[model samples]
Target chain A: GQQVQQSPASLVLQEGENAELQCNFSSTATRLQWFYQRPGGSLVSLLSNPSGTKHTGRLTSTTVTKERRGSLHISSSQITDSGTYLCAMERSSSFSKLVFGQGTSLSVVP
Target chain B: SVLLYQKPNRDICQSGTSLKIQCVADSQVVSMFWYQQFQEQSLMLMATANEGSEATYESGFTKDKFPISRPNLTFSTLTVNNARPGDSSIYFCSSSLGGETLYFGSGTRLTVL
Candidate 1:
Protein backbone atom coordinates (compact mmCIF):
# COMPACT_ATOMS: atom_id res chain seq x y z
CA GLY A 1 0.00 0.00 0.00
CA GLN A 2 1.14 3.54 -0.70
CA GLN A 3 1.78 5.80 2.25
CA VAL A 4 1.01 8.94 0.27
CA GLN A 5 -1.86 9.74 -2.07
CA GLN A 6 -2.65 12.61 -4.45
CA SER A 7 -5.90 13.92 -5.83
CA PRO A 8 -7.12 14.78 -9.34
CA ALA A 9 -5.12 12.05 -11.05
CA SER A 10 -5.38 14.24 -14.12
CA LEU A 11 -6.31 17.88 -14.68
CA VAL A 12 -6.79 20.18 -17.65
CA LEU A 13 -6.90 23.94 -17.50
CA GLN A 14 -6.64 27.02 -19.65
CA GLU A 15 -3.38 28.91 -19.86
CA GLY A 16 -4.41 31.50 -17.31
CA GLU A 17 -6.32 29.25 -14.97
CA ASN A 18 -5.13 28.22 -11.56
CA ALA A 19 -4.80 24.72 -10.17
CA GLU A 20 -4.99 23.28 -6.68
CA LEU A 21 -3.32 19.90 -6.21
CA GLN A 22 -3.85 18.00 -3.00
CA CYS A 23 -1.83 15.39 -1.06
CA ASN A 24 -2.47 13.19 1.94
CA PHE A 25 -0.04 11.07 3.95
CA SER A 26 -0.76 8.14 6.20
CA SER A 27 2.26 8.41 8.48
CA THR A 28 3.96 11.19 10.35
CA ALA A 29 5.96 13.42 8.07
CA THR A 30 8.79 15.69 9.04
CA ARG A 31 9.31 17.10 5.58
CA LEU A 32 7.16 17.64 2.49
CA GLN A 33 8.35 18.63 -0.96
CA TRP A 34 6.83 19.09 -4.39
CA PHE A 35 8.48 17.90 -7.60
CA TYR A 36 7.82 18.08 -11.31
CA GLN A 37 8.57 15.04 -13.40
CA ARG A 38 10.24 15.77 -16.68
CA PRO A 39 9.12 14.17 -19.93
CA GLY A 40 12.28 12.11 -20.00
CA GLY A 41 11.56 10.60 -16.58
CA SER A 42 13.80 12.90 -14.59
CA LEU A 43 12.58 15.08 -11.75
CA VAL A 44 12.94 18.75 -10.94
CA SER A 45 12.48 20.04 -7.40
CA LEU A 46 9.89 22.79 -7.14
CA LEU A 47 9.39 23.60 -3.46
CA SER A 48 10.28 22.04 -0.10
CA ASN A 49 8.25 23.17 2.89
CA PRO A 50 7.54 21.00 5.89
CA SER A 51 4.65 23.19 7.08
CA GLY A 52 2.90 26.49 6.77
CA THR A 53 2.58 28.40 3.49
CA LYS A 54 5.58 28.88 1.25
CA HIS A 55 5.67 30.55 -2.14
CA THR A 56 8.14 30.37 -4.99
CA GLY A 57 7.38 32.06 -8.24
CA ARG A 58 4.06 30.70 -9.50
CA LEU A 59 3.98 27.79 -7.06
CA THR A 60 2.77 27.77 -3.47
CA SER A 61 2.84 24.86 -1.00
CA THR A 62 0.95 24.62 2.26
CA THR A 63 1.35 21.65 4.56
CA VAL A 64 -0.79 21.09 7.63
CA THR A 65 1.21 18.60 9.68
CA LYS A 66 -1.54 18.03 12.18
CA GLU A 67 -4.09 17.31 9.49
CA ARG A 68 -1.68 15.08 7.55
CA ARG A 69 -2.42 16.86 4.28
CA GLY A 70 -0.93 19.42 1.90
CA SER A 71 -1.93 21.50 -1.11
CA LEU A 72 -0.08 23.04 -4.02
CA HIS A 73 -1.40 26.11 -5.78
CA ILE A 74 -0.28 27.12 -9.22
CA SER A 75 -1.37 30.59 -10.29
CA SER A 76 -1.35 32.01 -13.82
CA SER A 77 -0.48 28.66 -15.24
CA GLN A 78 1.39 28.34 -18.50
CA ILE A 79 1.61 25.58 -21.08
CA THR A 80 5.08 24.74 -19.90
CA ASP A 81 3.57 23.80 -16.56
CA SER A 82 2.01 20.77 -18.19
CA GLY A 83 3.51 17.70 -16.56
CA THR A 84 3.19 15.35 -13.61
CA TYR A 85 3.54 16.86 -10.17
CA LEU A 86 4.47 14.61 -7.24
CA CYS A 87 4.32 15.19 -3.52
CA ALA A 88 6.81 13.32 -1.34
CA MET A 89 7.12 13.02 2.40
CA GLU A 90 9.99 12.09 4.64
CA ARG A 91 9.42 10.39 7.96
CA SER A 92 12.24 12.42 9.41
CA SER A 93 14.21 15.44 8.25
CA SER A 94 17.70 14.10 8.88
CA PHE A 95 18.76 12.23 5.73
CA SER A 96 15.74 10.01 5.45
CA LYS A 97 14.21 8.58 2.29
CA LEU A 98 10.94 9.98 0.94
CA VAL A 99 7.66 8.25 0.21
CA PHE A 100 6.04 9.67 -2.92
CA GLY A 101 2.44 10.11 -3.95
CA GLN A 102 0.91 8.82 -7.18
CA GLY A 103 1.12 12.29 -8.77
CA THR A 104 -1.17 14.85 -10.42
CA SER A 105 -0.95 15.22 -14.14
CA LEU A 106 -1.53 18.82 -15.21
CA SER A 107 -2.17 19.82 -18.79
CA VAL A 108 -2.41 23.52 -19.49
CA VAL A 109 -3.96 24.52 -22.79
CA PRO A 110 -3.98 27.86 -24.54
CA SER B 1 22.04 22.58 -3.58
CA VAL B 2 23.90 19.65 -5.18
CA LEU B 3 24.03 18.68 -8.84
CA LEU B 4 24.26 15.02 -9.85
CA TYR B 5 25.53 13.63 -13.11
CA GLN B 6 24.60 10.12 -14.25
CA LYS B 7 26.40 8.27 -17.00
CA PRO B 8 24.80 6.37 -19.87
CA ASN B 9 21.48 8.16 -20.03
CA ARG B 10 20.01 5.00 -21.53
CA ASP B 11 20.98 1.34 -21.70
CA ILE B 12 19.66 -1.72 -23.50
CA CYS B 13 20.87 -5.10 -22.32
CA GLN B 14 20.07 -8.72 -23.06
CA SER B 15 18.63 -11.07 -20.51
CA GLY B 16 21.17 -12.82 -18.25
CA THR B 17 23.65 -10.01 -18.80
CA SER B 18 24.70 -7.30 -16.38
CA LEU B 19 25.26 -3.55 -16.48
CA LYS B 20 26.45 -0.81 -14.16
CA ILE B 21 25.06 2.70 -13.74
CA GLN B 22 27.15 5.45 -12.24
CA CYS B 23 26.21 8.61 -10.37
CA VAL B 24 28.53 11.45 -9.50
CA ALA B 25 27.70 14.43 -7.41
CA ASP B 26 29.08 17.89 -8.18
CA SER B 27 29.69 18.38 -4.46
CA GLN B 28 30.16 15.95 -1.60
CA VAL B 29 26.90 14.67 -0.12
CA VAL B 30 26.43 12.60 2.99
CA SER B 31 23.96 10.18 1.45
CA MET B 32 22.87 8.85 -1.94
CA PHE B 33 19.92 6.72 -2.97
CA TRP B 34 18.85 4.61 -5.93
CA TYR B 35 15.27 4.56 -7.15
CA GLN B 36 13.34 2.56 -9.73
CA GLN B 37 10.19 3.51 -11.62
CA PHE B 38 8.13 1.52 -14.04
CA GLN B 39 6.42 3.27 -16.91
CA GLU B 40 3.59 5.54 -15.70
CA GLN B 41 4.27 4.57 -12.08
CA SER B 42 5.63 6.34 -9.04
CA LEU B 43 9.23 6.02 -7.99
CA MET B 44 10.31 3.43 -5.40
CA LEU B 45 13.37 3.71 -3.25
CA MET B 46 15.82 0.87 -3.88
CA ALA B 47 18.74 1.30 -1.53
CA THR B 48 21.00 3.70 0.27
CA ALA B 49 24.62 4.00 -0.85
CA ASN B 50 26.62 4.59 2.29
CA GLU B 51 30.02 6.17 1.94
CA GLY B 52 32.92 4.10 3.31
CA SER B 53 30.52 1.25 4.12
CA GLU B 54 28.29 -1.36 2.54
CA ALA B 55 25.04 -0.06 1.09
CA THR B 56 21.77 -0.52 2.95
CA TYR B 57 18.96 -2.36 1.19
CA GLU B 58 15.30 -1.55 1.25
CA SER B 59 12.48 -4.07 1.32
CA GLY B 60 12.26 -6.20 -1.86
CA PHE B 61 15.77 -5.11 -2.79
CA THR B 62 19.00 -6.93 -2.01
CA LYS B 63 22.69 -6.23 -2.34
CA ASP B 64 23.20 -9.36 -4.46
CA LYS B 65 20.65 -8.30 -7.04
CA PHE B 66 21.65 -4.66 -7.09
CA PRO B 67 25.16 -4.27 -5.77
CA ILE B 68 25.85 -0.68 -4.74
CA SER B 69 29.24 0.81 -4.13
CA ARG B 70 30.05 4.23 -2.76
CA PRO B 71 33.77 4.62 -2.57
CA ASN B 72 33.60 8.22 -1.47
CA LEU B 73 31.20 11.04 -0.76
CA THR B 74 30.76 12.06 -4.39
CA PHE B 75 30.57 8.84 -6.38
CA SER B 76 28.40 5.73 -6.31
CA THR B 77 27.44 2.91 -8.63
CA LEU B 78 24.50 0.50 -8.85
CA THR B 79 24.97 -2.68 -10.78
CA VAL B 80 22.21 -5.01 -11.92
CA ASN B 81 23.28 -8.59 -12.19
CA ASN B 82 21.52 -11.01 -14.55
CA ALA B 83 18.94 -8.53 -15.71
CA ARG B 84 15.56 -9.64 -17.02
CA PRO B 85 12.76 -8.03 -19.01
CA GLY B 86 10.85 -7.44 -15.82
CA ASP B 87 13.75 -5.36 -14.57
CA SER B 88 13.29 -2.69 -17.20
CA SER B 89 12.63 0.73 -15.72
CA ILE B 90 14.09 4.17 -15.14
CA TYR B 91 16.75 4.27 -12.43
CA PHE B 92 17.34 7.55 -10.65
CA CYS B 93 20.29 8.56 -8.48
CA SER B 94 19.52 11.16 -5.89
CA SER B 95 21.23 13.03 -3.06
CA SER B 96 20.43 15.79 -0.61
CA LEU B 97 22.21 18.28 1.63
CA GLY B 98 20.62 16.77 4.76
CA GLY B 99 17.59 19.06 4.64
CA GLU B 100 14.69 20.38 2.64
CA THR B 101 15.28 19.84 -1.07
CA LEU B 102 16.63 16.79 -2.85
CA TYR B 103 18.57 16.80 -6.09
CA PHE B 104 18.23 14.16 -8.78
CA GLY B 105 20.27 13.09 -11.75
CA SER B 106 18.82 13.06 -15.23
CA GLY B 107 18.19 9.31 -14.66
CA THR B 108 19.20 6.15 -16.49
CA ARG B 109 16.58 4.43 -18.60
CA LEU B 110 17.25 0.69 -18.53
CA THR B 111 15.68 -1.84 -20.86
CA VAL B 112 16.31 -5.56 -20.75
CA LEU B 113 15.19 -7.84 -23.52
Candidate 2:
Protein backbone atom coordinates (compact mmCIF):
# COMPACT_ATOMS: atom_id res chain seq x y z
CA GLY A 1 0.00 0.00 0.00
CA GLN A 2 1.11 3.58 -0.61
CA GLN A 3 2.34 5.25 2.55
CA VAL A 4 1.25 8.71 1.53
CA GLN A 5 -1.76 9.89 -0.51
CA GLN A 6 -2.48 13.36 -1.92
CA SER A 7 -5.78 14.68 -3.14
CA PRO A 8 -6.77 16.82 -6.13
CA ALA A 9 -4.21 15.28 -8.47
CA SER A 10 -4.24 18.61 -10.29
CA LEU A 11 -5.36 22.17 -9.56
CA VAL A 12 -5.76 25.35 -11.57
CA LEU A 13 -5.99 28.78 -9.99
CA GLN A 14 -5.87 32.38 -11.13
CA GLU A 15 -3.33 34.79 -9.81
CA GLY A 16 -4.28 36.12 -6.36
CA GLU A 17 -6.56 33.14 -5.68
CA ASN A 18 -5.87 30.67 -2.93
CA ALA A 19 -5.05 26.95 -3.16
CA GLU A 20 -5.27 24.07 -0.75
CA LEU A 21 -3.53 20.69 -0.99
CA GLN A 22 -4.25 17.64 1.14
CA CYS A 23 -2.15 14.74 2.33
CA ASN A 24 -2.97 11.53 4.21
CA PHE A 25 -0.59 9.00 5.61
CA SER A 26 -0.40 5.92 7.76
CA SER A 27 -0.01 6.01 11.54
CA THR A 28 3.56 4.82 11.24
CA ALA A 29 4.68 8.18 9.93
CA THR A 30 6.58 10.19 12.50
CA ARG A 31 6.57 13.43 10.56
CA LEU A 32 5.09 15.01 7.44
CA GLN A 33 6.73 17.53 5.11
CA TRP A 34 5.65 19.54 2.09
CA PHE A 35 7.83 20.10 -0.97
CA TYR A 36 7.56 22.00 -4.21
CA GLN A 37 9.24 20.64 -7.32
CA ARG A 38 10.23 22.92 -10.16
CA PRO A 39 9.27 22.00 -13.71
CA GLY A 40 12.98 21.38 -14.22
CA GLY A 41 12.88 18.66 -11.48
CA SER A 42 14.54 20.43 -8.54
CA LEU A 43 12.76 20.01 -5.22
CA VAL A 44 12.45 22.70 -2.57
CA SER A 45 11.38 22.02 0.98
CA LEU A 46 8.30 24.04 1.81
CA LEU A 47 7.38 23.15 5.34
CA SER A 48 7.44 20.36 7.89
CA ASN A 49 4.48 20.12 10.22
CA PRO A 50 3.97 17.37 12.73
CA SER A 51 0.91 18.78 14.45
CA GLY A 52 -1.04 21.98 14.76
CA THR A 53 -1.01 24.74 12.17
CA LYS A 54 1.95 26.72 10.87
CA HIS A 55 2.11 29.87 8.81
CA THR A 56 4.84 30.95 6.40
CA GLY A 57 4.26 34.01 4.27
CA ARG A 58 1.15 33.15 2.23
CA LEU A 59 1.53 29.44 2.92
CA THR A 60 -0.05 27.56 5.80
CA SER A 61 0.33 23.93 6.86
CA THR A 62 -2.05 22.21 9.20
CA THR A 63 -1.52 18.67 10.44
CA VAL A 64 -3.86 16.50 12.48
CA THR A 65 -1.91 13.71 14.06
CA LYS A 66 -4.96 11.93 15.39
CA GLU A 67 -6.46 11.65 11.93
CA ARG A 68 -3.10 11.15 10.23
CA ARG A 69 -3.74 13.85 7.68
CA GLY A 70 -2.34 17.25 6.70
CA SER A 71 -3.18 20.14 4.41
CA LEU A 72 -1.25 22.99 2.77
CA HIS A 73 -2.99 26.26 2.14
CA ILE A 74 -1.48 28.68 -0.33
CA SER A 75 -2.95 32.16 -0.27
CA SER A 76 -2.70 34.75 -3.03
CA SER A 77 -1.38 32.41 -5.64
CA GLN A 78 1.17 33.78 -8.10
CA ILE A 79 2.35 32.75 -11.54
CA THR A 80 5.59 31.39 -10.17
CA ASP A 81 3.62 29.06 -7.88
CA SER A 82 2.78 26.82 -10.81
CA GLY A 83 4.49 23.53 -10.19
CA THR A 84 4.07 20.16 -8.45
CA TYR A 85 3.34 20.16 -4.72
CA LEU A 86 4.46 16.98 -3.00
CA CYS A 87 3.83 15.63 0.49
CA ALA A 88 6.20 13.21 2.13
CA MET A 89 6.01 11.12 5.28
CA GLU A 90 9.07 10.29 7.31
CA ARG A 91 9.46 6.80 8.76
CA SER A 92 12.08 4.57 10.35
CA SER A 93 14.04 5.04 13.57
CA SER A 94 17.24 6.58 12.31
CA PHE A 95 17.70 8.88 9.28
CA SER A 96 14.96 10.82 7.50
CA LYS A 97 13.74 8.17 5.09
CA LEU A 98 10.71 9.57 3.32
CA VAL A 99 7.71 8.14 1.43
CA PHE A 100 6.19 10.49 -1.13
CA GLY A 101 2.76 10.98 -2.58
CA GLN A 102 1.96 11.19 -6.29
CA GLY A 103 1.79 15.02 -5.88
CA THR A 104 -0.70 17.72 -6.84
CA SER A 105 0.17 19.61 -10.00
CA LEU A 106 -0.79 23.26 -9.61
CA SER A 107 -1.00 25.79 -12.39
CA VAL A 108 -1.54 29.44 -11.63
CA VAL A 109 -2.47 31.67 -14.50
CA PRO A 110 -2.94 35.41 -14.84
CA SER B 1 20.03 24.64 4.08
CA VAL B 2 22.57 22.38 2.40
CA LEU B 3 23.13 22.61 -1.30
CA LEU B 4 23.72 19.44 -3.31
CA TYR B 5 25.34 19.24 -6.71
CA GLN B 6 24.91 16.22 -8.97
CA LYS B 7 27.27 15.53 -11.85
CA PRO B 8 26.25 15.12 -15.48
CA ASN B 9 22.85 16.74 -15.03
CA ARG B 10 21.62 14.45 -17.84
CA ASP B 11 22.95 11.38 -19.56
CA ILE B 12 21.91 8.85 -22.19
CA CYS B 13 23.50 5.45 -22.50
CA GLN B 14 22.94 2.24 -24.38
CA SER B 15 21.46 -0.83 -22.79
CA GLY B 16 23.87 -3.19 -20.98
CA THR B 17 26.21 -0.31 -20.23
CA SER B 18 26.89 1.07 -16.76
CA LEU B 19 26.97 4.60 -15.39
CA LYS B 20 27.61 6.43 -12.16
CA ILE B 21 26.06 9.54 -10.65
CA GLN B 22 27.86 11.48 -7.96
CA CYS B 23 26.37 13.69 -5.23
CA VAL B 24 28.32 16.32 -3.34
CA ALA B 25 26.94 18.31 -0.46
CA ASP B 26 28.26 21.77 0.28
CA SER B 27 28.30 21.07 4.02
CA GLN B 28 28.70 17.89 6.00
CA VAL B 29 25.41 16.16 6.62
CA VAL B 30 24.40 13.39 8.95
CA SER B 31 22.55 11.30 6.38
CA MET B 32 22.25 11.04 2.61
CA PHE B 33 19.60 9.06 0.75
CA TRP B 34 18.83 8.23 -2.85
CA TYR B 35 15.47 8.43 -4.58
CA GLN B 36 14.12 7.49 -8.01
CA GLN B 37 11.23 9.12 -9.79
CA PHE B 38 9.77 8.08 -13.12
CA GLN B 39 8.14 10.59 -15.40
CA GLU B 40 4.88 11.82 -13.83
CA GLN B 41 5.26 9.51 -10.83
CA SER B 42 5.99 9.97 -7.15
CA LEU B 43 9.52 9.78 -5.84
CA MET B 44 10.44 6.43 -4.31
CA LEU B 45 13.23 5.94 -1.83
CA MET B 46 15.90 3.60 -3.09
CA ALA B 47 18.48 3.42 -0.32
CA THR B 48 20.27 5.21 2.53
CA ALA B 49 23.94 5.81 1.89
CA ASN B 50 25.76 5.57 5.16
CA GLU B 51 29.24 6.89 5.66
CA GLY B 52 31.85 4.13 5.74
CA SER B 53 29.27 1.33 5.58
CA GLU B 54 27.11 -0.55 3.13
CA ALA B 55 24.03 1.35 2.04
CA THR B 56 20.67 0.22 3.40
CA TYR B 57 18.35 -0.45 0.47
CA GLU B 58 14.62 -0.41 0.66
CA SER B 59 12.31 -3.13 -0.62
CA GLY B 60 12.54 -3.85 -4.38
CA PHE B 61 16.06 -2.37 -4.51
CA THR B 62 19.31 -4.29 -4.35
CA LYS B 63 22.92 -3.29 -3.91
CA ASP B 64 23.92 -5.48 -6.82
CA LYS B 65 21.90 -3.52 -9.36
CA PHE B 66 22.19 -0.06 -7.81
CA PRO B 67 25.35 0.04 -5.80
CA ILE B 68 25.97 3.06 -3.55
CA SER B 69 29.17 4.22 -1.98
CA ARG B 70 29.44 6.90 0.70
CA PRO B 71 33.08 7.44 1.43
CA ASN B 72 32.58 10.58 3.53
CA LEU B 73 29.85 12.75 4.99
CA THR B 74 29.55 15.07 2.03
CA PHE B 75 30.09 12.66 -0.88
CA SER B 76 28.28 9.61 -2.29
CA THR B 77 28.11 7.84 -5.60
CA LEU B 78 25.41 5.62 -7.05
CA THR B 79 26.28 3.25 -9.87
CA VAL B 80 23.82 1.52 -12.12
CA ASN B 81 24.97 -1.84 -13.43
CA ASN B 82 23.47 -3.73 -16.35
CA ALA B 83 21.38 -0.72 -17.25
CA ARG B 84 18.04 -1.20 -18.99
CA PRO B 85 15.39 1.06 -20.43
CA GLY B 86 13.28 0.66 -17.32
CA ASP B 87 16.15 2.06 -15.32
CA SER B 88 15.75 5.42 -16.97
CA SER B 89 14.50 7.98 -14.45
CA ILE B 90 15.44 11.04 -12.42
CA TYR B 91 17.70 10.27 -9.49
CA PHE B 92 17.85 12.62 -6.52
CA CYS B 93 20.28 12.66 -3.65
CA SER B 94 19.02 14.17 -0.43
CA SER B 95 20.66 15.08 2.85
CA SER B 96 19.53 15.97 6.34
CA LEU B 97 21.26 17.96 9.05
CA GLY B 98 19.90 15.77 11.86
CA GLY B 99 16.53 17.40 11.52
CA GLU B 100 13.13 16.66 10.09
CA THR B 101 13.72 18.90 7.11
CA LEU B 102 15.46 16.99 4.30
CA TYR B 103 17.05 18.89 1.42
CA PHE B 104 17.30 17.47 -2.08
CA GLY B 105 19.63 17.71 -5.02
CA SER B 106 18.68 19.06 -8.43
CA GLY B 107 18.58 15.44 -9.70
CA THR B 108 20.30 13.53 -12.48
CA ARG B 109 18.19 12.68 -15.49
CA LEU B 110 19.16 9.28 -16.89
CA THR B 111 18.04 7.75 -20.17
CA VAL B 112 18.91 4.15 -20.94
CA LEU B 113 18.36 3.20 -24.52
- For DockQ, the strongest prediction is 2
Each model's lDDT: 0.91, 0.90
Fraction of native contacts under 8 Å reproduced by each candidate = 0.72, 0.83
- Candidate 1 structure quality by residue, lDDT tens digits, A91-110: 87654568888899999999
TM-scores of the candidates in the order shown: 0.97, 0.97
DockQ (Cα-based) per candidate? 0.75, 0.78
Query: Docking category for candidate 1?
Result: medium
Q: Where in model 1 is the C-alpha error above 4 Å?
A: none
Q: What alpha-carbon RMSD in Å does predicted model 1 have with respect to the real structure?
A: 1.1
* Candidates in order: C-alpha RMSD to true structure: 1.1, 1.2
Q: Predicted candidate 1: interface RMSD? A: 1.3
**Backbone clash pairs in model 1 (N, Cα, C under 3 Å; residues 3+ apart or in different chains), count:** 0
Kindly provide the TM-score of model 2 when superposed on the true structure, using C-alpha atoms: 0.97
